[model samples]
Target: MRLRLLVIALLTVSFLGALDNTVVTTALATVAGQLGALEHMSWIVVGYTLASTVLLPVLGKLGDMIGPRPVFLSSLVVFMLASAACGFANSIWWLIASRVVQGMSSAGLQLMSQTIIAHATTPRQRPKYLAVIGAAFPVAILIGPLLGGLITDYWGWPWVFWVNLPVGLVALALASFAVPRIAGGGRARFDIAGTITLTVGLVALVLLAAAPGQGVMDLWMLALAVLALAAFFVVELRVAEPLVDLRHFANRTIGIGIAISAIVGVGLFSITAYLPTYFQMAYRTSATVSGLVPIATVFGMLVSNLGTGWLASRTGHYRPFPIVGTALGAAGLATMAALPVGLPLWVPMAVMAVVGLGTGAFMSLIVAVVQSAAPAGETGAVTSTVNLVRQIGSTLATAVIGGVIAAGVAALLPVGLNAATLTPQVVHAADPALQERIAQIYRDVFAPVFGFLAVTYLIGVVASVLMPRGRLSDSSDVVPAAESVTA
Candidate 1:
């Protein structure tokens, strides 16, 4: 019963954090209109993403230094408060500021939830629980836009933020009772220099990827990211207690796990971000119906995630799941790339389900692999590092994919067909000939994007092939060192 409550609490928190990533997406237009900041609407989402991405490692390190429970609870409190602030904001800047704070707290919630689970469960038992927690993200992504649209339509756009208050309170209550107090590593000193350099690098890199226009600014951001990251590496090497221990990457299992995590991120985000747009533009589906299209993918993910977790936990050897998964994902993506736009919707849905099956296999296993190999004391840091890499991968891929679509549309669309104004309504209301041309443009543009995603999954297959084979440890409290874990 107690274990059930803990898992419930963790799942709720995970959903809350992940949901915010996409929930506001559908509400952006409503928000911009009401808040009178049409030009700055993107900042509402960008602010949250930036804060959360930059804070992952910082919060993870804090969890390792002072234990996860307190960090978890503190983050929940801040998240709830910021959620309220977001709901009540009368101006766009206020809402954006509140979202940034909410995002910072969300980083802690996301990182500590995983860390707490890692601390609470053994390697052998971790997969199943992590599987449950892992499902929250895709589930949240699946519902976020739909839910946001409903709330924005029925109540108001603010309700989207307000809704978190109730859910967060419930999670807080359960977590307060169910989470065990785990001790942290005794070290209290923080690597200020390392944090600064890393933050600078990550911010620059993320901005560069997410930047709207290209040229001089992009070059400057790239140079700044490169220099700051180089400095971060040097600082980590010299620091007594680094923010991110550079040595973890030297471990074969850890390295492979991180690599696969990034690839999975690229594949997952690139598909989810663009598919709805494709449906709306090509199929002329309603936003609500378009949002529902990914249900097939999420369903496949949930089924495979749970099954793989159960099987891995039972057998102890976990190496085969990702290998099989990545191959399936590659084939599925290749099929999707080749699919005709005129085909029945169910056909593409089926293909995405196959992609989801491949994705779900990796969701929990990579975390388990990394946590299993990390020192018990450094579990939080290592877990956060892997998650951070995944976030970076997703962010970069989404931006690149967006660029691909934008460039393709620009070249293909006739003169005066402004891409920015080509909403579903506009496309559907156009003359049949124009509609056909627009749909064809989407088909041509997205085919290559799908191909790019398939290539990523192929890379995942290679990484999975190189992964060191080993059985997960059975002891609940012991994390074997990297060398000891290798068979």
Candidate 2:
């Protein structure tokens, strides 16, 4: 009863955080108008995302140090407070800053749920639980725009943030009552130096990815990000107990799994981040109506997740899924790429369904594989690392795509504007006519962006070759294989 209850509470919190991540997309324009930040609206999402990514690993480590109970509780409090701040924010900067805090706080919630789930369920039952938790992200992606649109249209943008308060309170209540207190028992001093270095490195890397072309920060920022990451690697290797256990990657299965997962992350998140833009630009649909497109993707995810879980249980084979799933993903992406500009709305929606199916079939499988390959105690570090790589992948996809959009916009600049002199902000701030011109340019430029997913999954295909062949039964974390590995 207690375990089940804890899982429910954790799932709720996970859904809330996941919902917050995507729910803002349709609301971005509304937020811009309200906050007078049309030029800087993307960061509202980017800042929260980057902060959440960087802190996930740190919070997981912290959970190992103190107890996940406290960390989780603290996260709820901080997240709620930040949400309130976001609701009442008077300026764009305040909203952005609150999102950063919310991001950092929510990191604990995300990691702890995974940690707790892994800890709570035996290997045999893990796949089902992972599915439940995994469902949150795709569901949120599906629901966010619809919910955000509804709230934004009726109540206003503030309600988007305000909506969290009541749900957060419920999560806090359930967590306090149901979740177990998990502590590391080790008295080793916290590796402050390593922590600081890695945090700096990750922040720099994510910021470099988020920076628009020739923003206030430029080449020097990129260089600094690289240097900090190098320093982080050095410090982690030398530390007696580093925050991120680099040793986990020494296992071939784990290392390859992380790489594949990261690539998957890049593909999945980029599609979610930009699909709305495609709808708005090409189809000329209202945000609410455009949101319905992702439903096809969500439906694909839902069916694939349930189906994959059943297949993994029956066939007892795991490797074939990722292998086949990536191929499907590549195919879907290629199909999407082939769609003509301003193609009928139904076409890309169909393509997105295929992409979601591929993603659903593969994603949780990777998480299960990586976790199963790692030792129990190292779960926090390993889980966080995989998620970190995924977040980095997400950041990279957005950055690269954003760069493409900027370059496309620059190339199509009208006769009066100087391409060399223009900043992204300047381009955005231009009159409605210029904005329309840029939008048309971006729509054309982004068509081939789907090909990037094809490339990403091609790498996944090669990585799948490196995957060990095992029946899902043998791969069972939830249940033992019907036939033994030795057999």
- What is the lDDT of every predicted structure here? 0.87, 0.76
Clashes of 2: 12
What lDDT is reached at residue 87 by model 1?
Answer: 90
* Backbone clashes, each candidate: 0, 12
Candidate 1 lDDT, 1-487, residue by residue in tens: 6777888999999999889867888899999899899998988988888899999999888888887888999999999999999999999999999999998999999888888878777889888889989888878877888889899999999899999999999999999988878778868799999999999999999888877487898989999999999999999999999999989999999999999989777997666878889988877777767755688888888889989988888888889999999998999989987887767778888888998998899888789889989987888899899989999999988898899898898899999988887788998889989988888899889988889888999998999999998898888443221111201
TM-score of 2: 0.85
Off by over 4 Å in 1: 284-286, 478-487
Worst 10 residues of 2 by lDDT: 478-487
User: Positional deviation of 290 in candidate 2, in angstroms?
Assistant: 4.3
RMSD (Cα, Å) of model 2: 5.6
